[model samples]
Structure formats: structure tokens, C-alpha cells
Target: MTAYEYKVVPAPAKGERARGIKGTEARFSHSLERVMNDMAADGWEYQRAETLPSDERSGLASTVTVWRNVLVFRRGKAGDVAAYQPRKLDAPKPYVLTTPLAEAVHDQQTATGTSDPDQPLAHPMNTLVALPVASTAPPETPRLGETPEVARTARVAATDNGVEETQDLHQMSSILRDRAARLIAAEQPGRS
Candidate 1:
């Protein structure tokens, strides 16, 4: 279980010149709601949320006055029978926005002057993948002695040099399996 702090800051009112912008408040509200929903989905129960009083002495216009609200989420403790108790949640890491993987790969390939004939080309930024809001639990690790059949197949394929077709098929299958595993691992819980 963990504790997380989520904040909702009201968008500062725009100047009269910019008052006609569409969807500004709606977008901000949706973003804040999504953050809260995501935390709830991750097994974090809402502990508390409150708005702090705004200071009028700061000379800012009342319409533009900012109200700060905070939401604290906490996971329940484990059962009492456990041998070792889990530690409290650590401070969250700073958020750094990143390009989606496909876009990043495309950018890298373009920078390096290499192009793949098999893949369709598109703008890298257009493929950005938004992350899910809630954090998931970690995946269980595989046992040490559990060797998958694909490993054996790969070994056999490596020794058969005379059969080009079989080797090619095996290599492609191995590549696909590896890629799938990588994607699954990336999506697994406790990744943050």
C-alpha cells in the first residue's frame, strides 16, 4: 500500500482579451477529475481533500484569485500476520513527460539516416501513448528453474545451419516472443 498526494489548482482567470477561448475550464476540470479517478483506480482510498482560504491582501483580482485543494490517498496496511511489515510510501518521483516509444524510435531512426522498408512512416509526435492514471501492483517474478520451451527451440534452431527456412522461422519467432515479453514487462505493475 502507498500514500500519494494529488493537487488540483484552479486555472487562473484569463485577461479580458483572452476570455473567448473555448473549453479552458472544462479541460482543466476534466484533467483534475482524471487524476483523482486514476488514484482511486490504483487502490488508493481518498483520505481527505480541502480548499485553503485565498489571501485577499495580495492585490490580485478576486476573479483571478487561486484556491488550492489537496487530495491525499492511502492504501490500507497489510494483515498482522506478516513476517516483515511493508514500509511507508516514499516521496513520488518528479514527473517528466516523454515522447511515445514509436515516435521516439522514429525520431532516432530519422536522425541516424536509417529507414525500415517494412514499417509505415508517420509523424512521431502523432503517436504519443498516454499512460493510465492508476499505478498497478508489481508482477510476480518467474521462478529460477522454469525454463520456457522457446529457449530450447532457439538453441536447436541455432545448431541447424543447413536448413535456412527453419532457421529464419525460428529467428523471427524468437524475436516476436522477446518483443512481447518486453512489452508485457513494461506494462507490469510497480513500474514507477
Candidate 2:
């Protein structure tokens, strides 16, 4: 929670004269502006103007209630903390898929040595496949401060079930990826 300090001061009684500024209302507004500006320069925020009643003796025994105009201002205290401000979430990245599904599946199958589906490829997930791409640019250079990617074949997810189960799941994913690619390819025109 934030703590604030408040200050109350009397409003200007009269406006200061200025060239080309004519009218009682305009002059009064100018006077108020002067007070507000002065307060602002001192790091005070103008809150509101109030008309407060004060009782004072008019004569020997007569008492009268008089209305007084005062300006209110407030500022954050030295030890005050700022209000909670939630951080904005970053925008989600879009998936950019360019290749026609059938073509991509064919390429992936060829690279993974799964082009002949009759026989299973040994260590399918262990082998890295480099698909044909149009870009002639030399392989990307690692950006500054970016950690180098760990070789996929050497990386394994440690799970409660032994490493063999993890390898089985990994191989299953590779099979699914290939199946999904082929299914998508079968939907494309001119693909068997």
C-alpha cells in the first residue's frame, strides 16, 4: 500500500493583472492557475478546492459563520511504496510452415531412411535429418550470449520410469511426427 502526505493552502483572493486578459472570471481562473502552478513546482499535486465554514466573533457578542476557500494538494511520502502494476504478457509466436505437406513428408522420410516403410530404421530419433531448403545462406551463427543447442542424440529426458521408457517415448514421437507428415501429405493435391 502507498502512503500519501497532504497539504491544504488558501486559494488566491484576487487575480494578478495581465496584458490582454480581461474579465473577472478569467482573472480568477488565472489566479487559481498561479497557485496550482506554484504548488506543482514544489512537487505537490492539486487535489481539489473546498469551501469550509469557520465561526468567528463579528463584534462584542455577535458570532458569524464565514465560508473560506482552500486548495488541497497531496504527494507520495518518502517511505511510500508504489501501487501494484501487473507486468504485460509477451505476445505468442506464430508457427511458420512453408513447405507443402506431401513434399515435406517425402523429404523427412528420405532423410530419416523411412522412405521404405516396410523396415524400421535403427535409432530413428538418434539420427538428425537435414531437409532440403531453398535458402542458400550459410548455417546460422550463434547469437551473442545464446547458449549452444545440446546435440539431440546425446540428450535424454530423465523420468521416473528408467531411461529405456524415455527412449521408447522419444522413438514414438518420431514415428508420430512421420505419420502426421505423411497424413498431411496424403491430403495435398497430386500426392498419392
Candidate 3:
């Protein structure tokens, strides 16, 4: 509703040194703080800082871009009070997801009344809560006239399948060791 004026100035490159400041980072921050305070004392509200490019002549006919840091400040204009009404922003719409993940969340919410996780209706003394994994993808059905394609998977015989081929991780290592031993023996001509 009110018009505004802006002021921009070059920011301090280094921090101001003080008796109590120990590190360069601390000193630099102190310097920046001082600049902000000085501007605020003059009734200027602190705004955002920006990096802008400036073009400068490099040689006889060449130009180069130099990045410059600046601090921005703003205040209500003293003279202009009736012009430039800023556009009002509309509120964002509520997010409604209909995916399987959202459906799973809804299912879990109904099961334990975990919709409000802070005060779960079913669980009271739980230190850690693990959310149920939702079905990531829906199964694809074959078209009316088209047959479903099948993948060829090797069927291992019960006799040929060793203990090393078991689902256990430790058992898999035994198979690797056995294969390594067989390879070493084959490489040696003298050892049958």
C-alpha cells in the first residue's frame, strides 16, 4: 500500500579488526555488522546483498566483466505515497496426492491412527517409528489381444546347488574361495 525507495552501497570487503576478535572470519563478520548498524542508524532497513557484473576495458579493444558485491537497503519514500501499488500474491493450493504411496500412508493412518504421529492412538511408548513401505509401482496387465512376454530364468537343480549358493551372505564367500582354489590348481601344470 505504501511506496518505497531503495539504496545500494558497496559492501565491506574485509572484516573490521577489534581487540576481542581472534579469527579473520570473526573480524570480517564484525565489519559487516558495523556496516549494517551504521545504515540502520540512518533509518534504512536492511535488505538482501547482491553480486552484479561490471564491464571494464581490459586492453585497447577488449572488455572484461568484473563481479562486484553490494548491500541493498530500503525505506518508505518520503515524497511518493500514492503511486506504485505492489501486486498481491495468491495463497498456494493444498497438495492432494493420489499415488499408491499416499494410499499406503492413508492405510497406515487408519490402522494405528498414526495420521497425527505426535500422539499415535495405538502406539504410546515407541521410541522409533518405521513407516510401512508403499508399493512403488502398479503391475502392468497384458493387452486384450497381446500376450504377456516372459523372461528366461535359469532353474538350478537341487543336487548341483551347493551350500555356497544359499541365500546367506557368508555361504556366498565359500563359493568364491572354492572357485579361486580350483583356478590356482589348474594353473599349476605339475599339480593335478
**Runs in model 1 with CA error above 4 Å?**
1-22, 53-67, 79-192
lDDT by residue for model 3 over 43-112, one digit each (tens)? 7998899999999999999999999999999988877755555668999999875566466556666776
Residue 46's C-alpha lDDT in candidate 3?
Answer: 89
lDDT of model 2 at position 161: 43
Query: Candidates sorted by TM-score, descending order?
Result: 2, 3, 1
Q: Across residues 1-192, which tens digit of lDDT does each residue of candidate 2 receive? A: 677899999988888788788998898889888889999999899899999999999989999999999999998886654454566899999875555644655566788767775566555464354566798643355456554463222233322345343333434567788999999998998987
* TM-score on alpha carbons, each prediction: 0.23, 0.45, 0.40
Give me the candidate number with maximum TM-score. 2
lDDT of 2 at 49: 91
CA lDDT of 18 in candidate 2?
81
Candidate number that wins on lDDT, 1 or 2: 2
Q: How much is 175 displaced in model 1, in angstroms? A: 99
lDDT by candidate, in order shown: 0.59, 0.74, 0.75
Which residue pairs collide in model 1, if any? Answer: none
